[model samples]
Target: MAVVKVDKKGRLVIPQEIRERLRIDETTPLIFEVDDGNTIRIRIIQRDDQAYTSDPLWKAIHNPVFIGKKVSKKELDEIENDQWSN
Candidate 1:
């Protein structure tokens, strides 16, 4: 158990030991919830590189959309071949 102080900006730093044990990094996403109007629960969402690659929803959320003109399959293949040859 660890006691943390909330600063004026409402930010509390998790202890180093806890962070190390949980493998929490800067990219980690945390979910905070108040339980029973008294207890606060912090849920850590941990995912590996493989998870992001395998999960379609994650890919959809992170992948950028094509907004410009649409190219045909032949055009795309030609572009790929040209890049590979160079």
Candidate 2:
């Protein structure tokens, strides 16, 4: 229900109210579809329960501290277990 301008770079800034209502965050993924070359539909890709629970482990594996280094499965398992144990 809101009209927004597409910037020169073709990026649209979603309004704050809409973002808050839709619970959109920086990490959120969106699917954009064009229908009849006139209507644009945006769908938010939501993470399932399992993905939500493992988010911490995913983040830890990609953490800046591990950048440019290969983390072993054992190390990842330890990190995941450590998070749950605490």
Candidate 3:
């Protein structure tokens, strides 16, 4: 394994080989998660770069909702039946 130094800004410079292997670039977005023991792990958040403007489903993906509503199986069956009837 190659040794890399962390800069004064608390940023660790990834080695060239590691960077190429991870396919990381300046635009790559990373997320850090800490476990119960306070051990931090870094992960890259990758997004599908496909651009779709005409699809409503694709647009809704960016604006998600959490209404905190409890949905039941009967309600799901009713909704599916309504959709099928239409």
In order, the Cα lDDT scores of the candidates are 0.85, 0.83, 0.76
Stretches > 4 Å off in candidate 2: 49-86
Q: Give the true-structure RMSD of model 3.
A: 10.3
Candidate 3: list runs displaced more than 4 Å: 1-3, 36-38, 49-86
**For candidate 1, which ten residues in a row score worst on lDDT?**
45-54
In model 3, which range of ten residues has the least summed lDDT? 46-55
- Candidate 1's TM-score: 0.56
Instruction: Tell me which residue pairs clash in candidate 3.
Output: none
In model 1, which regions exceed 4 Å deviation?
48-61, 64-66, 69-86
lDDT for each residue of candidate 3 in 20-75, tens digit (9 for 90 to 100)? 99998997867678876946677876665443334578578867766679889999
The local lDDT score (0 to 100) that residue 85 gets in candidate 2 is: 100
lDDT of 1 by residue, 1-86 (tens): 99999999999999999999999988897778899877999988656656546778878788966758989999999989998999
Q: Which residue pairs collide, candidate 2?
A: none
Number of clashing residue pairs, candidate 2: 0
